[model samples]
Target chain A: MALGEVFLIPTVLQDDETALESLPINIINTVRNCQVIFTENERTTRRHLKKMDRNIVIDNFQWFTIGKIEDSILDTFSQQLQLGKNVAIVSEAGCPGIADPGQFLIAEAQKINAKIHPLVGPSSILLALMASGMNGQNFHFMGYLPVDTTERKNAIRKIESMSINDNCTFIFIETPYRNVPLVKDIISNTKPSTRLCIAANITAASENIRTKSIQDWKKEDLNYLHKQPTIFLLDGGRQYAPKSHY
Target chain B: MALGEVFLIPTVLQDDETALESLPINIINTVRNCQVIFTENERTTRRHLKKMDRNIVIDNFQWFTIGKIEDSILDTFSQQLQLGKNVAIVSEAGCPGIADPGQFLIAEAQKINAKIHPLVGPSSILLALMASGMNGQNFHFMGYLPVDTTERKNAIRKIESMSINDNCTFIFIETPYRNVPLVKDIISNTKPSTRLCIAANITAASENIRTKSIQDWKKEDLNYLHKQPTIFLLDGGRQYAPKSHY
Candidate 1:
């Protein structure tokens, strides 16, 4: 049981029924059987659960830990799983492998072959790109940027270059406050003609989808402040090649 | 009212109740709220409605022509909408924007502010990318390729170069039988190390999601002669740049 320190569970964005239903019945079943459950924020999960009010046995658990990578917290989940006891891994929202803490636990789960399965659901990132009619086939998902100023700016430059140089849709997330500066960097750094699709407050009422060439942006576009959740989709301006036929 | 013509409605590739419920409401409230609905195959929609056991009001107009565009069908839908009567546009399957008749209507709609609102749902292309864990932020969905050899080879070149030059995922779909040869061209024509992720039988029991470097593919990899639905995801091998700040 390689100290099944952690097990992965998924929480979807919004209260989207589609995303909730997309979870493999097996994973949910497993969670129901688990002895303990760990969430980034147990209080939020408990409140959300109470509202949904489904008859599930998984609700009661010896809940524990600070949300982010607390070393002792990892030990608690890991030791239980390793001992062949079931443990649940929950993100505040969305799929696990995405730009979230679940990745580390997932990698560990993969290394152990601990019966892992990624249940599919509504990814705000994917939803935005699909509707934007930009490149939905090939695009990078470089989770979140580093906290350091230089590294963060460098990551943005790399993304801008990738968008212009190869015509790839470069995607990244910014902490709420960084939204203004990030948008500014994009405006000042990338080619004026680059196509930008910003999906802000996705899956929520404030949900908005705006797309345009960089040069076309007016000051109003920058007014996307005070909004906490946002996903940026940049069109890599590579020339289009005809699709290959038989 | 503008002369409304019959419309082609592809089966949307999702099974979410809220989304389906929201579609008519969204289209009627926002997009052209017209008096009629035309489809390539209303029989299927009727069957779907029966399966869901919902009493949907579908007014019968005329059968839509498949494979060829009918001018008369276009006239009826276009005219009614133009005359300030709202018209509804749908497909027999999936979203209209990807490789379908909807593009023609959508382009026309955009030109006239006939208002196009593409709702979010399960797209085979996006689903494939999501499962592959490859690039999702930037990708080029080059619909279907032209079938001529010289032109197709040229198209492959464009796909290959984009991967190497920009690192965007190149997504393509082929008739079930042609996937093997397409893989051969990608392997022979591009760098041997390019990564390829092909997801066949997506969202179904016989689903196959396989990833292999170009050089690692064996005769076995090309052995599938599946008569199943497929979406091919390929990594054209774009070089990652040295870190830079945006």
Candidate 2:
């Protein structure tokens, strides 16, 4: 029997119906076709599934919570594929296998040669980069910084320097509550001429994406980002460089 | 008056109705609201606009072709924004401002403080990374490798070393016709254990995405990639290293 396909479904970044506008219509069909689901958070996934299609019987599918992708879960996942049971993987928010633990299961599926389809949806990283007006051709997604203050500062400096040297944009995220601290560290550590983009509440009614040099950013009141879901982008290349040096 | 909002519209990777399934339903509304359009290719954008909504009168909106974001285009874009006329920017394919010249115009819009809304759509780079099952938390998009044979080989080696050292996934693209040649270079230059993903014709009926070690890739026939839009990803990190070694 042919191995069952794996579908990577992306969830809304915000918990509002309006946030669902970022997802394509076909995702509903794919989700309906899957008999098994591996989700980051079962509760949120259930709610999201219900939002996608109210008629979907949540209890009819076998659900697996993806915490660490342990050996037992892999075994069960592989077994389901062997039995030709289509499976879907959903993240807590945004696209799976990106800045999330879903990649482990995806890697396993690739090893088993299962067909994997990644559906389009809201991705803060991608959305931020597209609106930043920075170098998108060459960019790096660094996920998050260290929780330790000192280590995080070091990371910011390192990424800023890397961006300047490579003419590449560096993207990173921080805990919603720590957004202000992260921005502070960024402002204090980076050069005055370095360009920074703060994209907050993407896809929501309060969405704001602004790019400015570090010196210019110092004049703004950033208290609005205190607890907002935000993605920060740093571009250290010379101002208005037609193309990236690399 | 408030500065005009700029919409970053993403087009289908493949020119098929099925490919349109990846786009969100709301994009049609945003496209309709815009009174001015700056597109990479006018003919294709006209066809795409008609496809999005048959009732859309193409000549109703003022269209500007974006070859290079020169002074003339920037002047027109800024003038329209100053007039509070909403504008949309469309790429030839995929998301604008990504691996495309749309960023230049976006950068100009940023300077003018225009609200930029980046709509969700098909992006080969993101889709490839998600399906590749590589280290998505930390990945670098290098755009394209050097076209020169010797420089391209050197650049591949450099990126391979960078990936190994940083445990970061490196993504790059090539002209469709040169896909095989770039793969050949990657195979010959990288270590046998390096993981590579070849994603072609993404979001289309003939889509193919596969990930394998360099050694395993050597055994497959890759001639099918000729003239097929493709993205290549390389991860030199040790096999299945749980998290990227930043």
Candidate 3:
């Protein structure tokens, strides 16, 4: 018996076509062939499909809403695969499995020995890291900081310490509305010379990416980041000269 | 005077169009508009550009080879930007500025206040992580481990310890020819129950992504990984039950 294959698809970061264009042509063909679709938000997935190909009949496929992974949900997936139904996991933004509920579906697929395919697309975290001009050799992506003020401060301190000690770049994102406060915390809590890269609006037309010292950032106007999706990066370690003799 | 712009472009992971197709269409247009290009490897960049668009007059554009960073190279970049020439940085594989020499160029651009644009494409590290079904929220990409036998063992131990202590996924790559030995070291050193995800030949037709326990992997033949580009992931931490009381 043939086992059902699971495709890990990627979506655009913003609502524009520029980010969507990054997807390979085969992804659209893959969408056309899938029997069942699992996504965080069905409406956005439909919209993305429509943009990919206006000819795609959105109602022809079975759509499943991926919520918290429960045992029943795992069973449902297994039964579908047992029936040889192809499954595609889509996310609301960027790659499905990263920082989303899609990983639960992937974990189930892995346990059952299903063939998994990961398609490529825009990832805001990687894009931000690529443009940040910071240390990329070693880096940490801390999805989001704690919501509590004290805990968030402590987390920021820990990130700073790690960046300096490991010679690594630390990356973290925040809730859209909390961008300003997070920047403020980062600027105030870290060392004066710590390098900070604030990448906002990602693939959008208003994209802003700049790397500056904490001291320099403190002197700039930050009104541009209001209510925007952003990724923050810090490289606190002192720059090593090209070579040093032992 | 308007400053020159710098574009960070991604290349195909394999010598095929499947990975290249993930790049946005604007990347070709960006290439057409740029007067100068700085690439890690000029031959590969030329081949990629030709593949992106056959009609592109490759001779019309000035090409610069990115060598080790030094004062003269930095001065050349500044001079080009000062002349208001749009520049593009191309990598041999994946996105430039990440695990490539392009980051140094980007850093120089940022220093001169040049506009930087990061286009979207396939990144094997991120793609592997997205498919690993492991913890994506907290992860580290350690470019490569030490080559010495004792140091390599210690590094593997430390990675496992970090995974268990921080609940973070540890990712690293090895030289293509050394993959088999690295796997052996990982299996012999880590706990039997530690989960390891080996993703090899990503974005290629022969791509393989599997997440298995060290014990299970030890039982299987790993001769397939010889001389292949692979991403290794260790999630030694216990899988947290879906719910945990605060």
- The root-mean-square deviation over C-alpha atoms between each candidate and the true structure, in angstroms, is 7.7, 2.1, 1.8
Fraction of native contacts under 8 Å reproduced by each candidate: 0.06, 0.72, 0.60
Worst 10 residues of 2 chain A by lDDT: A237-246
Question: Considering every candidate listed, which one attains the maximal lDDT?
Answer: 2
Clashing pairs in 2: none
Residues B1-246 of candidate 2: C-alpha lDDT, one tens digit per residue? 888999999999998877988899999899989999999899999999888889989998998998865677778889999999999999999999898888888989999899999999989999999999999889999888999999999999999999999889999999999998999999999999899999999999888899999999999999999999999999998655434421
**lDDT for A235 (candidate 3):** 93
Clashes of each: 48, 0, 0
Q: What lDDT tens digits, residue by residue, belong to model 3 across residues A1-246?
A: 788888888888888656665666778888887899998889999999999999999999888888767666667887788789899889899887788878777877877888888987888889989998888789999799999999999999998998999999999999889999889999889999899999988888878889888999999988778899899999997653433301
Off by over 4 Å in 3: A240-246, B243-246
Candidate models: Cα lDDT each = 0.55, 0.90, 0.86
Runs with alpha carbons beyond 4 Å of true place in candidate 2: A241-246, B241-246
Looking at model 1, residue A97 earns an lDDT score of 43
Q: What is the interface RMSD of each candidate, in Å?
A: 7.5, 3.1, 2.8
TM-score for chain A, prediction 1: 0.77
CAPRI quality of model 3 = medium
TM-score of 1: 0.62
TM-score of each: 0.62, 0.97, 0.97
How far in Å is the alpha carbon of B35 misplaced in model 1? 5.9
